[model samples]
Target: MNPSPPLAPGLPVLGNALRMMGDVQQFLVDTYRQMGPVYRVRALNQAFVIMAGERANRFLLERGDEVFSSEVSFGGLNSEFGMRVHVLRGRPHRHLRKVLATGLSRDLLAARWDDVTAATERELAQWRGQRALPVVDRCQRLAAAQLSVAFTGANSAARFATLRSAFELVLDVTIAGKWPAAALKLPAYRRARAEILAFARSCLAERAAHPTGGPADLLDRANEAKDENGNPYPLEVRAGMALQGYFAGINTVAYLYSFMMYALARHPDVRARVLAEVDAAYDGDRLDFERLRGLPALHGLVLETLRVYPPAPGSARTVLEDFDFEGFRIERGKRVLVATSVPHQLAEHFPEPELFDIDRDFAAGRRASVYAPFSVGSHTCLGAGMTEVLAVATVAMMVRRLTVTAPDRPLRITATPGPNPGRRFAVTVAGRPKI
Candidate 1:
């Protein structure tokens, strides 16, 4: 058997823990570059084996199901947020994914396009009298608006307000495993989980009460989906699916939309091209799915934004079976940190990787195994198609109806929950007249 992966340089007992304290993604990338494909590092008491780089990422993505167990790895999140698609394995995972697909699938993104646009317009309506507004917060509001209406028929900001903050609390405790297990039992966590569960159940009840009207929402679709044996999922299962679809897509899309807007603001050349393309694609006031899919400049801008400012970059997995990667042995049941985005930052995949240029061709990266903005393999994001539609359509709508401008300065980014524009990353937004 091949020997274990080499150990990374670290201090006495703490190991590489101190280094990871600041910018976890950066630390992962830098470590992969220095230590090669596979290596080990410790955080205070526990040592985690990290497999990354281009070759390693491809291997993990192609064979992840055989060797890595997401359900075991994300146990903390599962216990806190309850079982969702991200925490299920094998057939159960695929079954729930099918239920989630009832709402998040590509076909629905077009059929339910009105719902998405309505949410955008509603949130944009609220931003009429605002300036220098923290775009991240507003983006979160926008995302919550779409996800809320899409998951349930509810679109009121006041109703989503509590669910938004409660879900944020859930991520805080479980995102990076920063807190100990006892933290899960805190009054704050208890309250947060209760609020989230309560929100899901209330939406389910409301949908059951008035199931006949409006566009088909996630709850409606999930409720109609049958299991492998042709039986409808139970209430608890449906609730979890809705919660997963609703809460899972919010922050990622929020961060993405915020960055896409900022990328437009910060780069004038790209902005001009995107504006021209969006203007040409509109058939009067409507943008059909066909035209939406055909905007190369806007599509490039979205892809570039994800390449540089990926929200949910790396995923943690527990090794399910012993495997050798790049001549290093990964033992079963040990938690492994997979740096899925390492390739995005690598010059080999994206030339001048740090620069945010929408002009770069992503064909090669797509052909290779380098790009994974929505993650990779079986657990790839269910809302990816919707996310694209949201980014493309919302940006186009804002460009048409809202005067949005950010400071001609560098963006201040943070990665607590995920990479986000700082609170001060505000834009000047106001209503614009349409011709």
Candidate 2:
């Protein structure tokens, strides 16, 4: 068999771990340049083929389950989070996915637009009154609260609030690996998991008690969903799905929301144009899905933000069989990563890739397919449509109701649950007009 892609040179024993941890995006970029699309880098004491570019991404994401194992790739997360929705494959995955789809359906999200808008407005209102705080932290908390309400109805706010820090700790563990993860799993993390289970059990009980009287929410959708044989999902499965969706949704969308707003504040002229669109869409009164949908600038801004700052920048898959990938003979059981951020920055794919321009026409041609921020195919983000709506609504409301300016201190990207501001940076917000 042809040798696996060239192994990246690294320090004795440690391999490329330091480089990978130092600056993951840059390491991927630099390695791709020196070694081309396929190369091997070691992390956590194991070697993985680092695959870059849109073609590689499409290959891994689209046809992954056929030859690459999601369970093997994502199973590490289960140590802390339990059997999350992403870890399943084959029939079980399909069944869980079907249930999740119903809850995150466009119809459901549209029906819940009022809650989304109200959440955005409430967060912005708080920001307007505050003197200073890390906008990223505040945005994350807002996203968690909003998603909690959407998932389990209004009563879930306090429970979700309690779970947020523990959720953060879990994310840390998932990224840090077995030893570090084990060491970090303190009482707080256990408490958080217990609280989540308790809250989920309560939701299950609530759904059973009022099968029809309660307001429609994610739990209701999960309760009503069926497996391949038409059996409703077990309470444990439903609860797991709810918790999984909450963790993924809040973490990714929260950073994205802050990033988009950060972009708007950094670019005043673009902000002015976007705010104009938001105001025009609002017309005089309430903001609904119809109005929000019509705001082209806001939609463009959201897309632009995702392209620049994908929350899940890289996705991994474990090879199930020996295979030829791009003329390289990859062996069975080897893990490979589809380095999305590399292609996202390729000069050919996006000219002057570093520039943040909202006017980029992403709807047509290669740009559309090339942009895989939320990934594509079977593992594509289920909440994509909802996230787009929330990102637009939240940013638009912030701009329309308040003037947001970036702090003098540069905001550096760092991983909290995902890539976010290295430290909390103040974004000054003052009233624009009473909404």
Candidate 3:
């Protein structure tokens, strides 16, 4: 029998909680480097097997569905939103993913380009000539606003604060694990959840009222969705599923968009390259997904930024049974942290990974084993393709029409549960500097 993974140094019941609480991505990356691919971390009563690097990623991701369960780990999060995609396992999960594919497809994203740009432009309009705009807050508002229009066809600007507060509180308790499970019992959380549900219901009702003869959105497809048995999903399930985009994204999108914008601001050369590509790629007012494929610098910048600043810590899953890999054992019901982005910053795979160089050849070592920014295998992010497309296109829009800058300041990241641009990351914006 192989020995259990070594436990990281920790104090008393707190274990690694203190260090893990701040900058989880960097802490995990640094831990993966100092402690090998497999190790154990404890926080009070909770314990997790930290797995990273290529071999661990292969064993965990490629065989994740069989050996691990998402619902087991994050059922609480899923339950709050009443969505199954974030919690369900195996066949049922695949079926739901297929059902929702129509909404998440590239074609749908292309169709929603106008709304995407409109939301972004609206938010940036407020930032124009503003002193010290909070990038994370602005990006969160912008991302959520676009998510509202693109996903549910809802104009959510007025309810943006409620939406942000609700989603942020839920993630803090759930995926972020920053708040205790009992945090959900607080009046603030309850109110937030109620508002989210109410908002979801309104989207459903609006979609039902005007079924067709409009640009198709997430709610439209979901409203028509039949489950695996070719029967309509229950109204409750449909309602939950309608807000899946907001439930699963928003924060991640906000952080990602925030990081990309910061990267463009910090790297003038890269910014110029991305701006030039965006300037030429536009076909009048229409710059769709396909149009972005030819822009190497812009695409590379997005990938590089994600590699550097992974929004969330890592994919969370709970082991279903006792298992051993890499000469170590993980017990049944043990929480597992698959640090998928570990390799994203690993020197062996990325060579001077700290340096931001977008033009580097990525295809050479782009296999899932070595680089999984969105994770790998069965539960790979459903919106991965669309998310990438959105990143590429949205960054283009930012550089083309706005200038965001912070003089004599370097990027700083704060992790409430996962990393985000820190307060000092505030930037001043002046509208559309000459390209």
Candidate 4:
């Protein structure tokens, strides 16, 4: 057996927990800096090896899916959402993945463009007289509005709001981990979870009574889907899928929209370039989906934002069997955490990685393995197409309606599990005539 690499020293009892709790990303980055590309840390009775850089990211993402498993990484989620047979590995997982992919197809996303644009316009109009909006909250509402219309139907606006609020509670608690988990047993968390579950079940019941006839919403489709054995997924399976989709789509979209807007506000030159592109593309009417996709600069801007501030900072996997890497052994059953932020900052893949350059031209025909924003391989984000659509639509709509100016003080960001600008960002919007 190959020998293991040196493990990072840790405090007794708490191990590295306190160090990680201080500033998680920085702690991980610092550990990587000291221990090289791979190092192990013990925290809360669990030991995890963190791998950094592009090459290491590729190896972990590609190989780990087959050998290691997301079962442990996603354990917290599974506990919260319940172990839906559909979301687990094997044939059921494949069937559900295929069904979910159908909703995010290019054609389907194009069909939903009207819903997205309409939501954006309506939300922006509400902000007409407002100044210094808490961009995170506003963006979450906006994303919820769009996702509700696209996933469920236009009538789900109120329900989506409730769901969004519930998810925010869940996310806030989960981000706090052990502390919040204990606290969550209190009345508020129970009430929120119960209400959200009830709302989801009610929606499912309504859909069952009256089908959309056309392509049904994801919840309805999953409920109606039959495997090769010709058995419909159980209700818990349906609920699990719905909850997963809700959490997956809403939070990430909100963060991306807020960050992109904040980035534009801070960088006027980039904003101007984006606006010019959008203006040139407009045909005196609605923004065409095809035209939006054609804007590589806008795409690059979104990509760069993700590279700089990835939503899921790290991914975890448990090694199923012993593996040798660069003359070191990774023992079986050991957990490995791949630091996504580190690879995104590596100079080898992204020179001058700190600078935000939308015209970088790094993404064109580049190997998919290099980028880990949405990750790579089987478990890559299913909402990727939807995210792109939302990002472009959000940026385009904001640019068309307002000239965003940064606040007196630069916005501070909290690099929690997801990156969000601190509580408030002040921006002034100079309006333009409606199209």
Give the number of the best model, judged by TM-score. 3
Candidate 3 C-alpha lDDT tens digits along 1-435: 889999988889899887776667788888887899999998766788899888877886668888898886567666777777777777778999887777777776667677777777777678889888888888878877877777766667787787777766766776657778898898987887888788788878876896756666678877888877788887767877787775567777878988887777778999888877888998776575577889999889977887888764578899888898888988888889898888878888898988999976666556646667777777777777777777887788777778887666665567764578765678888888564
Q: Write out the backbone clash pairs for model 3.
A: none
Per-residue lDDT for 53-166 in model 2, tens only? Answer: 777877775677787776665564554445456777778777777678767666665666677667767767778756675777787778877776666555345665666766
**TM-score for predicted model 1 compared with the true structure:** 0.90
Return the TM-score for each candidate structure.
Answer: 0.90, 0.91, 0.94, 0.87
* Residue 236, model 4: Cα distance from true site in angstroms: 1.1
**Top candidate by lDDT:** 3
Regions of candidate 1 where Cα sits further than 4 Å from its true position:
10-22, 44-46, 213-216, 229-232, 430-435
lDDT of 2 at 267: 79
Query: Candidate 2's C-alpha lDDT?
Result: 0.71
Model 1 C-alpha lDDT per residue in residues 42-152, reported as the tens digit of each score: 877677888887786687678988888887555555665554577777887788787777777666566667777887887888777577778888888898887766566
Note the Cα lDDT for every prediction shown: 0.76, 0.71, 0.78, 0.69
For candidate 4, write residues 197-293 as lDDT tens digits. 6766777788888887866566666667665467876666566666555455777888888889878877778887888888888878678888987
Specify the poorest-scoring 10-residue window by lDDT in model 4.
78-87
**Candidate 4 stretches greater than 4 Å from native:** 1-3, 8-30, 42-47, 82-87, 155-165, 168-180, 364-368, 408-411, 430-435
Clashing pairs in 4: none
